[model samples]
Target: MATLSNCFQPLKFSPKRHRFNSTSLFTRRCSVSATINQSKLDILLDSVKWDDKGLAVAIAQHVDTGAVLMQGFANRDALASTISSKKATFYSRSRSKLWTKGETSMNYINICDVFLDCDKDSILYLGKPDGPSCHTGSETCYYTSVFDSLHSSQAEGSKLAMTTLQSLEATILQRKAEISESSTAKPSWTRRLLLDNKLLCSKIREEADELCRTLEDSEEAPQTASEMADVLYHAMVLLSVRGVTMEEVLTVLRKRFSRSGIEEKRSRKLEGS
Candidate 1:
């Protein structure tokens, strides 16, 4: 049996805290303390009963979103690398060697934590992906649904089955690529916006004003939501044009999570001054 203390140590505080002013305590990157017992790693590895081919089932899950990114198998070395490097690594059964996720695609997964199932036969890796987890360019490996009766209903609900921002970002990237590849590619509103920065900025302003109007009509929740979506979409377009990712924006938000809104504002003011 492996204990948390034996496996890893708590994160150390940085001497320069201002560098992490926007980041939350929980979001702070931690180092695997030297105190971690080598015997503990051996104990964990020994607990797993690998298949005849010397592999254990490993599932990669999104740390924040709780989405299952992908599944693979891990040999002893792969598993050890994953733990030590804090990156997802698995054994490629076909290649008969260890493979690190995102090595070729640049869509690496940063592992936050790891877990073992009750049966101790399977491993779960919780991580944040740098880009699309699937080779097909989808956010997750399980994008297609074979039998999803609730899909239609879920689409109408407040919470979407898939992340709207991620989908929109992927679409924006595709449109940008298409436009770059061929000028004659059917002109899309998004493509046009991406090409003309001034027009995109204007559209964002227009959408933001419309969203503000919708907010005045508190009773019209659906209208407000629609207007807000338009604002978000345009904002995303601007971000895409600037070669900024949604993840980068989310990282800023994550950093501010631990601070009060007023404190954050004051800090910004101080910094500007």
Candidate 2:
């Protein structure tokens, strides 16, 4: 009898035939690739506490932002294929085939690492998505909240609700894009800041001073938080104007986390020297 690992060979499903009704099945290429030890992978797959259907919950999360992108089910083959391909692959229970996340839309999640939960029943695919993960063109799939879905006045709940920093960065980018396209449209505060360099610099200086004062004057927690928000907003506006992404900033911060602040500053100084 074939072992459980031998039973689930990763099926190369054609997205054209599976996702859409088309005559020709087009081949797509992914940028990421990897290889895993078969023996080790088989042993790990056998250890997983899969449900009766031989599937476990797999969640894809943004590597930089830690935002949950999408959730699906995966079997042994899906997991193995994900490791080898370096792209998130799921077992479509309905289609009964391997479904790579971005085969159709080209919004593939390029996985950096795979992690197993404490219970060994769930898997996490830590990755960076190339584009919007949701079918509705939102950044991530978990944008809608249960409370907002039921209580909001709008028929459809907000699909753009994300973490505060991600949301603010997106808003700033949107303002910049809108300002670029529509010259006559009324500008928002963010737009005005993008347009006027002197005003933006002044605002940044003002917010930074206020934020410092909050600590110096022993202001309330709320006041300090408010001042910090203003400073972050202005700084992010400057970043956007310079065409620098939040991801780049976050990547630098993440790198610095492995070292002391003094060490990081010293390295920067050395580079400048």
Best by TM-score: 2
Expressed as tens digits, the lDDT of each residue in 62-90 for candidate 1 is 76556688999998888888888878999
Which candidate's lDDT is highest? Answer: 2
Q: After superposing candidate 2, which stretches have Cα over 4 Å from the reference?
A: 1-39, 143-145, 152-154, 173-192, 206-228, 251-273
Kindly report which residue pairs in candidate 1 clash with one another.
Answer: 22-255, 23-255
RMSD of each: 13.6, 13.5
**Candidate 1: segments with Cα more than 4 A from true spot:** 1-26, 29-58, 64-67, 73-108, 113-124, 129-163
Q: Return the TM-score for each candidate structure.
A: 0.56, 0.66
Worst 10 residues of 1 by lDDT: 1-10
Taking the candidates one at a time, how many backbone clashes does each contain? 2, 0
Give candidate 1's TM-score.
Answer: 0.56
